[model samples]
Target: MAKILIILDERTLYLYQNNQVVRSFPVAIGKASTPTPTGNFSIINKLKNPYNKALGTRWMQFTHRMHGIHGNNQPSSIGKAISNGCVRMYNKDAEFLYDRVSIGTPVEIRQNRRTDSKNKSGYSYYTVKTGDTLYQIAKKFNTTVEKIIAINPNIKNKNTIYPGQQIKIPD
Candidate 1:
């Protein structure tokens, strides 16, 4: 299996195969104060032509919706620090990574130390919209309401989602 390394501190991503670095790309991490989260993760899911909601003043519980490594609908944003939290890549590059990765592949995200989290997995961030429900979002993503609730432990109840809530979708 191919290994992917995301170094948030260096603002670079490396894809490795058979023990050699196959490709590398520059990334725009969260601002200095808002450092990108560091941990071992996996691609739990995939999406295409993803739409991103800009980060605003509000504490978006459902912010980062439309967040995933997907084909860019707006190709112009590549190599820019534009996404609220999601990793934005060029359309062709994202598509290439998507094709090479699977649901259970391991992903290591590090800022200071290396990660050891194994098992292929993925995640997504969704912003709640008007008249939205956990169940509806789950169905749309082919996931379950319980799963969504599990990922976002802060949510007290499935029925309490408000518009502009940023929920994490786990695979």
Candidate 2:
């Protein structure tokens, strides 16, 4: 089965096939003032070349009809948080995803948060608790190993993680 896993904090949308990530694309999520909804959802409807300019080449509404994953005119916004609560992708990427996904495909949106007063990387920090494995932590935060490693340069070796080691967790 196919599924969509969207990590809102990381500004990435991934296409999962048979429980593994097959593809990912940068996305623009909702701004701080207007946060994107996070939860388990499914694609409910799809349209091509919607009448609205804000929804560029494609549109795919999920659980909520008011917001959706869509392309926009501003390609520069793809990796930034500037949308009005919807997920925004570049037109070509949007089309690529739209063509591969269908109505009823599952979508899971996640945004994890943590803070350390000493940190200034603009990313959340997770203090590894006893018995915490990277796999468990990643699953706990609804993130993937690749996403975790992308921000934490310190984690050069996945198997070397130990308890109490504070690591950067991409929000």
Candidate 3:
């Protein structure tokens, strides 16, 4: 059996077959303000090239009829938190996934906090988005950039961050 697992925090979609992950694809998820619901779900409807170009070439409606995993017209948005509660993938990736999965396939969406074996301070995680800056994030969370670095020792260059990159934020 094939199954889908979406880890919102990591912005990844995993394809599983026979209990093993066969493939993984980066995906864009709902923004922080409109986070994707976390729960067990199943693919319900599959549509190819729907009327909306924003949906790209494939649309798989799951537990929530309004929210589906679909192809994205904005390629750069993939792997970022920019969707309106839907999972967005590269057009080709969506097509690839669409060809393999069927309606009613089990889909599980959840958020997992990343923890490095060396450090586990339980700080909040934020997925970097387009035009995001370390200073901006620090200000948004009302913390100092130095504090963020203290919690996330892995961030060597506070000057550089790409969209979809996950970083820890102090609470």
Best candidate per lDDT, number?
3
Q: Superposing every Cα of model 2 onto the true structure, what RMSD results?
A: 11.6
* Model 1 agreement with the true structure over 1-171: per-residue lDDT tens digits: 777777654556778787677888765544433334444466665544433423211111112343334444555665565555555555567656766777656666554222223225566465565567788778866789888887788887887898656667664
For all predicted structures, in order, the TM-scores are: 0.49, 0.65, 0.66
Count of residue pairs whose backbone atoms collide, per candidate: 13, 1, 0
Candidate RMSDs in Å, in order, are: 11.1, 11.6, 8.3
Show where candidate 3 strays beyond 4 Å: 113-171
Top model number, TM-score: 3
lDDT for 67 in candidate 1 is: 34
Worst lDDT 10-window in candidate 2:
110-119
List lDDT for all candidates, in order: 0.57, 0.80, 0.82
- Tens digits of per-residue lDDT for model 2, 18-61: 88888999999987556676656899999999999889999999
For model 2, the local distance difference test gives: 0.80
Q: For model 3, how does the per-residue alpha-carbon lDDT over 1-171 read when each residue is reduced to its tens digit?
A: 999999887899999989899899999998866667555689999999999999999999985548899998899998798888899999999999999899889997756644211135556666676567789778756789899888777787787677777787765
